[model samples]
Target: MGKNRDGGGKDDEIIRASDDLLTSLSKDPSIMQSIYALLPNQEKLQGARDRHRSLFHQVVDGAHDKEAELEAARNDLIAQMSLVNGMANLTGKHDPTIPQKLGLVHQTAGKRPSAAGLSVPENFRMAYDGRSIIVRGSAVKGARSYEIWVCESDPLTEASWRHHATSGKINRIEITGLTPGRLYYFRIRAVGASDTGPWSNFISMMAI
Candidate 1:
């Protein structure tokens, strides 16, 4: 009798361990659904399915928002790069001598006209010899040629406008047959194939 009772207790222990293992495995959907008739009600299973679906939607929406932010940042960077390139195209290479070359050089007091156009530099000067007005100036270093416009008054009216000379170089030019003691205005501009610089400061002189 004692041996039978010990054998029965050992079998009960083995059966309990096997039942625990099977119960753990039944948490998986494929295994649990195959044994659904022996498991809990439909409402509890549906609740678990709805929880997983909600979690999936949350992850997808979060990923979509992140992508949108990344796209916006990418577009902003592209626009900034384009703006930098445009400014670089406008500025060209850095040439330290360009500013000095473009600027006007001052004239000595005796050589400068007292009552003529104020702020006209000595390098861009017009003087009156007894026969004609002599206009003189230097061209920008890369300039191919220059154009000179000699007028009687300011550029506000067309009646006073006339092209005095167009020259490949900056040299002394004599304008003859002008009325003595008459005020005249002149403008000089430098040009190249790619660009025309701003007009040199204007100079005025009277034929004495």
Candidate 2:
């Protein structure tokens, strides 16, 4: 398992807020370059203002320990550096992608996730919305990911089920592409590294 500095699968509201912020930060070209600059794996680029590794570590550690304060500081620094360019950070109490991006993990990408520790998803429901139906699910313990399978007809046979969507760490997903007011059957499963757990008890809903 990789050191999930991005908070692993823990779902804290504040952590999610921080993650959303960091994901936004990663988009700015200058800010992204700053991250790449400090990445241990990256070769120093010409003309890049390479920050001191000690200072970088300090910032990273501060993110984990002082997230609330870090949020304010991160915002202020971004505003201050609006013109200077190449300012970036991946520190946070919640940002899970940081460890992977910063070369801090040995995570194996594309490996099947395991579902041994999780039970079937619970509280599965469908939300009515104009022209779409949202599939909501509750997280299962010991699972890091989820797969939502949906069928337009009764799922009495394998051929009726279709893979719909997958989520990373979260339990809820929004689904579209169905005829409005059609009866749809849905089920979900916990995904593991090498196998998938049993499907949740199927639920049927009329799409709005």
Candidate 3:
């Protein structure tokens, strides 16, 4: 009876170990689903996934190539536009189609004469005041004040000499923030209540 009981005890231990392994595998849903699906159609699923992945990559590569071709075409169009603009300027005929910009260097604009006998500002003179140049001139009849213009380089064209400063109804004005010993060109115009006057002769002076 003792020998029979010992053999039965070993058999019970072996059966308990097998039950524990089965319980662990049953707790994992992913492992159970994988095993069930593979048993039915594993080969068909793998082949379909491989074919779809290859098609997806081919579509992505074609899109990238198309984008590169479009970028190259856009660059070519911009270069052609620049060339056309250059040709127009060479023929001394500015394209009216081009929009005007403030920062762009424009062609000289025609000036209409002021009401009769309105000449340039008279007695226009300058004297150094510390780091500034003092421009002084009296206004003639029909004149209100003056507009002053200055540039390091002479802007000979009327459009380039856009008035830099406007003075009060006084004869004297000071230009501050000048570089000492630097030569500056200045021009002035008599301004009436209604309209601007013709520009005066260019006056070149060195800042003291």
Q: Write the candidate numbers in order of decreasing lDDT.
A: 3, 2, 1
**In candidate 1, what are the lDDT values of residues 9-114, reduced to their tens digit?**
2445446766775888876657766755533344643554455455556556775545554554444443333333322322323542332343321222222222
Q: Which candidate number would show the highest lDDT if scored against the true structure?
A: 3
- After superposition, the stretches of candidate 2 with alpha carbons farther than 4 Å from their true spots are 1-115, 129-131
Candidate 3 Cα errors over 4 Å, as ranges? 1-113
Model 1 residue 76 lDDT? 45
Worst 10 residues of 1 by lDDT: 104-113
True-structure RMSD, every candidate: 41.9, 19.2, 37.1
lDDT, model 1: 0.51
TM-score between candidate 2 and the true structure: 0.41
Q: Give one digit per residue, the lDDT tens place, for model 2 in 16-128.
A: 65677688887765877885654432233212223333334666876455555555544443333321211111231146454345333332222223445556566655554
TM-score to true structure, per model: 0.36, 0.41, 0.41
Which lDDT values do the candidates have, in the order given? 0.51, 0.53, 0.55
